[model samples]
Target: MSFEELPHQADVRVRVRAEDCNVLFAEAARAMFSIMYVTCDEGEIERRVSVTSDDMQSLLIDFLSELLFVSEVDRVVFSSFDVVITGTSLTATARGEPFNPAKHLGGMEVKGVSYSGLTITRDGEGFCSEILFDV
Candidate 1:
């Protein structure tokens, strides 16, 4: 699985590819948080996240949005994730550390995850999604 940043006029756009739903969500989270901070601190801090939605599209949005919220409130930056999706709900274990401005190189400030122009396509190979982050 992999994710890459795309050019957007007003926000950050990312294209993520994964072999399945689980990895797709995890990679998306990595991309989102990585955009905010390139690297976190030394100590590992674990956080469990759960999000529910009406559909796959909404599920993706909610999952990333929840991660963003958690990071903001806890004052941490996540580097890894183990995500599992059951039906329209997702449960994830996120690992990171407290934000250190002196060490972690910061990137753009992402405000929210956007639905406009978002698309997820699955063929015989795997899942590919384009997600827009409102910055």
Candidate 2:
């Protein structure tokens, strides 16, 4: 799994490449957390997330949005993700610890995930996706 931040006017953009759909989802979550400067001490919390959508794009959006909500509500930052995708549904196991402002350096605040410039495609034996985040 790999991802790189792309230039955007005001929001944050990222391009993620992975060996398959599941890896792609996990990497995208990692990339978002990295961008937000979210750091966790250890896996003190584990949450399971399940979402269903009409298509891959919607599924990705819903998955990320759910993570953002979890971060805000639980006051934690996720560091690990185990994801399984089947058709338009996704189930994930997320692991992290409670957010400690004293220990973690905060980065940019992402307002939400955006659909602008979103794309997912097959690349060789892998997959690549581009996502835009509203900051």
Clashes (N, CA, C under 3 Å) per candidate:
0, 0
Candidate 2: where are CA atoms >4 Å away? 38-42
Score candidate 2 by lDDT. Answer: 0.89
- Candidate 1, 1-135: lDDT as tens digits: 399988988888999999998998888988898788877443589999998899999999998988888988998889889999999999999999898778776577889999998998994699989999987
The TM-score obtained by model 1 is: 0.93
lDDT of 2 at 87: 98
Best by lDDT: 2
TM-score of each: 0.93, 0.94
Among all windows of 10 consecutive residues in model 2, the one with the lowest summed lDDT is 35-44
Pairs of residues at least 3 apart in sequence or in different chains that clash in candidate 1: none
